[model samples]
Target: MTRPHGRFQQAFAKALFSSTEALDPAMRELATQPAFAVYRNTVMKACIDALEANFPAVARLVGSEWFRAAAALYVSAEAPRDGRLLHYGSGFAEFLRGFEPAAELIYLPGVARLDTLWLEAHAAQDASAADAAWVARRTPEQLAALSLRPHPAARWAWFDDQPVFSIWERNRAQGEVTDELAWQGEGALLTRPYDTVTWQGLTQASCVFLDACAGGATLQQAAERALAVDVKADLAAIFAGLLSAGAFTAPSSSPASNERTP
Candidate 1:
């Protein structure tokens, strides 16, 4: 059952977003007050500011003025569900997909998604990353049989037709896109190995390998999946790179029996 205070709180929240004329008699009077307007504006500004902070790459790609305007529209449609603003704007990427103004910038949504992944990786739970030494300790047969768990702080995605990772990385590092940049598909991987979040561009094969690993595939099976995507994929180099980036968690006591070789 809805408690009296809970109902009042919900009504007050709705009134803050709605026009004064839309509120009940009591709320309408309160909403018309100067303080109410100030509070509403402040709340909206805070949400917009949070989004700008969260998706800095997107904001940098588009100028601040444009980003803020778009963010304001998003804020009006979706309020923060979590008290912590760090987790806000989970839907901003999706909003960009359908946003008419951003239609011309085909890569905007991908950049926004990467920014969100970075935040999520940064906020993920602490875990010991599987280091190269850990892998070296296992024999080839043992490693092939083992199913590696992805680190809690790891996030990755592959973009089909846009150099999304390149664009995002440049803007994220406050660098300009050079004329030499190739317009091709790219993948991105984000991992918080230690204190700071780190990101690197990935190949489609690598992304597919990670996807297979996340789905409980053994090392050999994941390699096969990656090879299926790119016949010439360098499995050894890709595996080493992922290890260096701390993408996988420390191995469990034993291999998962449910996983099978193909």
Candidate 2:
């Protein structure tokens, strides 16, 4: 069912990252030309550059030489599907998890994941964040029955075995790591309530609460889930902090219908 031009396009794309011998007999001469070599190199460099920009924390963890080298391998295996390089490297974090060179640095994958989340938040659709005052206007009974939608720009994750948020935050900010940095599990929350993307470290309980909310749980149900995760969690403080951080959208009569899972 493939058209001739479509087949040629696919072959040409593959040829860019492969040897000229892989090209069809009709196009083999073109692939060996000097201009073809230059074009191929340019495409490869662009992909590597996109990965470097997209996964800055990973690049910072590894030196430029190492990062680019690994990125080159990734580029060969998975090229961008479109012209939007900002959305490239969506699978970089997962790739790093199975990458042999990164085996010793287990936290690197988590840091890469956080970096991807940052990009997702930055590129997410615009929406007004719900303020604490919105919750204040509701009665206790009304609040219990109301479901909260996560803002379209909100992204969060919990790294169970690594203090990924701490490491990623310091690296992303280009801050120096100190000896006092603890090696423990950590979570991260990234949100763009307004024009700029903002992030902060979170506890596992907070991540659980957000997950519950994203699944269309009511505020009271989300809080209960957070408590189930950590009996010592301060529900009032967590709820207030999340509200202040613009994590949720304004409550509506049909919150579940408008829900956008983070």
Candidate 3:
């Protein structure tokens, strides 16, 4: 049997997420004041506020009322497991996928996922980017044998149906949202080169190359993977882009303790 305190806490949690009128009779009697409703409203508001901060693009696209309604349902169904609200709603994208109201918005889940990743990358530990100059000086054999380390904040996502990167950028940009775009599959790479997190749309070859590097493959291996994905991919341009974007960390100076391949 559950202890009284345990049962009370469970009931209180349920009531917190449920309607005010649904409170247990004992709890209701204990809080015989209109202030109780204020408390409930405050809790709900805090949840909504956190979701708003974490998913600004989604909120902007969905409009306030719709977002609030969806957020309310999400909060009731999936309360934060921890007090760290920054990382709250980790599963919100998945939640939106099954949400009846958002069912028609096929691009929503991908956008939400990208937003979540942005938050995560923003909070990740900082590290210096691999020195492009130093790598450029390496001999062909040396470069082929060396493996680039993944940056602490490096992240990428592939969208099969929507131009998620474009949509996210448009919504985040200043001024009115642009509706004139040819929706198509897109991939995005995110990294924190400096203070701010940045994202860029990627080609399939770029995605494959980065995926290979992130999996600890050598430069030669990653290049081969990229070529396998797209024989015509501009390997030089991809390499330059990755270098300029600071998507990798110097193997020797990696903050993580992972082994640096020879």
In terms of TM-score, which candidate is strongest? 1
Model 1 lDDT per residue over 111-187, tens place = 99999999999999887788677678889999899888889999999999899998899899996556676889999
lDDT of 1: 0.91
Worst lDDT run of 10 residues, candidate 3, spans: 253-262
User: Which tens-of-lDDT digit does each residue in 194-253 have in candidate 2?
Assistant: 899999888889999999999989888998999998999998888888888999876554
The global Cα lDDT (0 to 1) of model 2 is 0.88
* Predicted structure 3: lDDT: 0.85
Clashes of 2: 0
TM-score of each: 0.93, 0.92, 0.86
lDDT of 3 at 7: 92
Candidate number with the higher lDDT (2 or 3): 2
Q: Kindly report which residue pairs in candidate 3 clash with one another.
A: none
lDDT for each candidate structure: 0.91, 0.88, 0.85
Instruction: State, as a TM-score between 0 and 1, how close model 3 is to the true structure.
Output: 0.86
Alpha-carbon RMSD of each model:
4.6, 3.3, 3.9
Better of 1 and 2 by lDDT: 1
lDDT of 3 by residue, 159-181 (tens): 87689988987876646865787
